[model samples]
Target: MADTYKFRIDHHGSLIRPAEVLNARARHAAGELDDAGLRAVEDEAISESARQQRKLRMSVVTDGEFRREDFRGAVLDTVGGFRRTGGTDKYGRAQWVADGEVKAGGPLIADGYDGVKAMAGTAAPKAGLPSPAFLAATCFDREISGAAYKSPVELGEALARIIRDEIELLISRGIRLVQLNNFRYASYLFSRGGQPLTLDEAIAVDSIAVDLTAKPEDVRIGLCPTHQVTGTVDRDAATRLFAGLPVDRWVLPYDKGAEGEADLLRAVPADRDAALGIVDPATAELEDVETIMQRMDAAAELKDIENIAVSPSAGFADTAGRAAISADDQRRKLIHVETIARMCWGNEL
Candidate 1:
């Protein structure tokens, strides 16, 4: 049988000073840094990030995503052959990007995967592979004749193809867990009329991705409602949609609290597990132990108590340093990690 539960943390996997790298790259491209100097800086940052992950005892360490200049916006920028085009949005005229004009394919991962494998091989943890969160808070839509692809079936298939390549690469490296970051799924659901997708449409999109990337016995799928959405998870809907799928796990947003836990308890089958985000990743405050216990207690009432993992709502640190939290913030974050570990492991709370 699959493990009942597991706990892990997301290491940003990006260099500590991403903005500096970007600025330097822009300068280098603009004839500032010499080629040798730029290469030295890149190598140094990559080395440092690996060292930091080991120091932090992070089980599933990422490559600090240093290779990519921007975590959220870089996909559009770095994917070879893609070009930015003007498009309209709810606000007004906007810039829309796509890959057709530049190339018929997506980003190649062979080199990037090799780099991660080399780094991970040296600092191999219990979990030997890195969890690359793809498609986080973004949608893959193309314009044909000046119209965005809005049909769920068409869009989902296109996304599935891209995601499939990523899965194949990770699997090639013998990685077991592949987390596809899909905040856009929830965003689309809550936009405007509050239900951009019907029940069938949502199920279709999710199931297609899961089927393409994972075998019925091998994969764990994570989902979260966008911040714009309110209320608990749609338990009945989730149960219906995910039933008989390979989704062995579910991860919900932290703020959903007791009601959200209950919803997951009902939605996830007894055989599967749930990952609860007890601490908010957006802030530096440590989660109160007493409060987490109450929430876990509520979850225990509904599902197997052993099947719970504690973690943050998203990655520990944001790619954009706008938050500017300090070292003290990381200390508090560690406290939340400890609290969840004790609870999930059934130690005294």
Candidate 2:
């Protein structure tokens, strides 16, 4: 496939909005805010999120996952064979993981692309889904998932099928970019710490899972891999796992220095592009364009500059309740990417 985009800057699905969403959700749950009132607030926020992305001159605009309470809640609730089993985290908040069969049910994502049009009115709307591999990796409970699935392999494949259906639905609606949110598990597989599933199988499974909708030329299929592989494992073999997949771009994470990034850059397939996560989301300090340029320059040293795009290390809102950076900081982070990229690419886009 020829390059679908020419040196553009955009974000993964979520955005950093004010605290209205979290507050509204709680109010609605407590019956203080009616469903209609909560929805009105969310709709307004989605519009604002899209408007912000457009203001940045982004090639893609996201609806900011404003409609969902948490990232995984969409698929876990709708999908068959999953029930919220009782659990809690270290924070003492009630927690739950899907414990059931991997059968199909409701749409994995409610339409953010359409929301962009009705609210923000942007032409470049990106529709993202939690990667099929994500459901496979996180939902594997032997006593729970195994009861429904013959084995872990079957659970993974079932997840791929359901996600394929969702992608096809999105493509049919003319949503062009389908971002598969692997949430860093793809890179973690290569790290020295042992991963439950084999790296080879994970790649193959994800490839089968996301190779949906339009031809690769027509659709921009992006993989958001967050972890930077560490030295405890075979970086050579692990890096090469990116070879010959249907994916169009690798939105890879880069939080540390650029020294170890060469092997990962070298591993990118000839046909695909690499989008570097330059800004660290864990901190709120705003980086100047020159700081972003430093990372771009480092990547250029490893590979041709044309194969790259730049973004933050993760979504601006790390969790629904937590904005990793202030909204102003997020805007600066995105603006720095576009401004620096323009300086590097002759100020065209």
Candidate 3:
């Protein structure tokens, strides 16, 4: 491993899309715009998003996942062979049935990475991929997916290969940071439905998905829960999950800064860092910097300040127009994270 990897301040991948981008998407869906035409608009929006992150002095920058309808939609959009069922999941998400063998149709996030790299002035470009666990759990159905694979486990392994291929291409393009949006873990924590894998199985699948053997030494990997997980977590499960994945950090939610939450920091392996999610993205209210600093202090008391950071609880917009917060509110929340980091770690951000 490299000596150290730290991100004093960061945000989940998605950002609120500007009105123009949304309109372009709507037009494209209606067959009013061609692929090239839609891409031009997306590229400009991504460039502007990168500039905004650089302006805020973010420790890491993303393409805002502007090209994707949802954060996890990338795999389904690029990889072929998933048959859409006219049904929705418990969370109102469109369901997909794995009926045929899957293969990468084209570049997944590399194009977006290129856009961020072009405009990321002083920050590292981060590409977030949905965890194979989450994709398999949510997309695979026992009866419908049986034609492609025997079980969701087999389907997950297949998706792991596809995602790994995408990761390899990204690394070849000089990406240093890759975060797996491992939202399925939240299912285990919150007892949500549509999850087929147990905690151990999900962890095992995640392990296979990120097994990068020859990546550069400084290429850091992280895990971020796409949904909010509040209150207490099972310490044993947390410890296994943190230590099991070969990642550099874990971005966890602490929206309410609930009692004994800081103690969960101990679950993170000493070798891995933890970025506390103190700023809530679902609401428009700005968080108190003093309260954010207090939460950071509690975490610092458990883990080294050098191994801690701050971020929004989740993406500003997992799906387009999903988050209730406006663009201005989103900026202020990110600024609060940056301000809190500066107070805790000086200019380390």
Candidate 4:
């Protein structure tokens, strides 16, 4: 609670990966390109992405998550002990079971941070880590992970430790803003969908993950809730996550409409920032800036304008080569967020 989290304009971490990065990844997967060659392509693309965010004057900048296939790739690709089941879960996410202890193979997303740090001159570099609760729900297979982890909670605890390590590494490298991408709580707890962990259990799992060793003031941790495609939170779940979690920011989904989410918006702690998902990222249509400002005005009524932030409903690209919005659309959407923030909060943005 250092009160250091000041970003009033934000976006979900992932941005659309350019074609060359995706093509290079395909070539690397096919053994046609080596690691160094693939990284070179990724680096160039990430540099451009950082430059664009800096250009947009976003207070917080990410590497566009270009190094990751999906946001979870930061952990799934770098961490060891997961065995691919060659199939997807009910949610359509690729299944990676815990065959052994979950542990990091090396630094997770450090290279991406390096790329951001080198290019994001004045903006605070942000790191996107997958939520342990989300990972546990999606990746923990009762049959496959049973030998390695007695329960989904057990797997989640392991993931929490690994994520804690990554957070430590990130803070040490001077990265201050860390956002956890979560969907499980919204899907199961908020929407009342069937799931492995209860809402309380999901929050407990995530709490363990963000129980960082670094000084709480040293890093600004946020949680962005998104369904695979579209989702929203019930008041109870929103209240629980916003009040119970130790994180400093909550990037909530409001693309469906802010009126319905007004009560949930009240759940955010006064000390934490509420980043409204005013623009829908799953569509190409740019949000009307006036309408977005009205939403911000509504949010301001519930919380201080300093505590209000704005972002897209979700990431532009959750996976490679599968963004619903065009590059121009993504840029415009972010610009809309910036514009809305300025109009609503003025110089605070």
Best by TM-score: 3
Model 3's TM-score against the true structure: 0.94
Per-residue lDDT of candidate 1, residues 304-335 (tens digit): 66666555665544343433455457546745
**Which 10-residue window of candidate 4 scores lowest in summed lDDT?**
225-234
lDDT of 4 at 322: 80
**Which stretches of candidate 2 lie above 4 Å from their native place?**
88-96, 118-123, 184-190, 227-233
Off by over 4 Å in 4: 2-4, 89-92, 188-193, 216-218, 227-233
> How far is 298's C-alpha from truth in model 2 (Å)?
3.2
lDDT of each prediction vs. the true structure? 0.48, 0.67, 0.79, 0.79
Candidate 4 CA-lDDT value? 0.79
* True-vs-predicted CA distance for residue 8, candidate 4, Å: 1.5
Specify the poorest-scoring 10-residue window by lDDT in model 2.
Answer: 89-98
Q: What is the C-alpha RMSD of each candidate to the true structure, in Å?
A: 5.3, 2.8, 1.9, 2.1
Q: Where is model 1 more than 4 Å wrong at Cα? A: 1-43, 69-82, 85-95, 99-110, 113-152, 187-199, 212-229, 255-258, 317-319, 346-349
TM-score of every model versus the real structure: 0.72, 0.88, 0.94, 0.93
Per-residue error at 71 for model 4, in Å? 1.2
Residue-wise C-alpha lDDT for candidate 3, range 31-92, written one tens digit per residue: 99999999999999999999999999997889888888787788978888786788876666
Kindly indicate the candidate among 1 and 3 with the higher TM-score: 3
lDDT of 4 by residue, 57-137 (tens): 898889888888788888888888786789975646677777778888778887557788888887788889999988888
In candidate 4, clashing pairs total: 0
- lDDT score, residue 208, model 1? 57
Root-mean-square deviation of Cα positions for candidate 1 versus the true structure, in angstroms: 5.3
2 or 4, greater by lDDT: 4
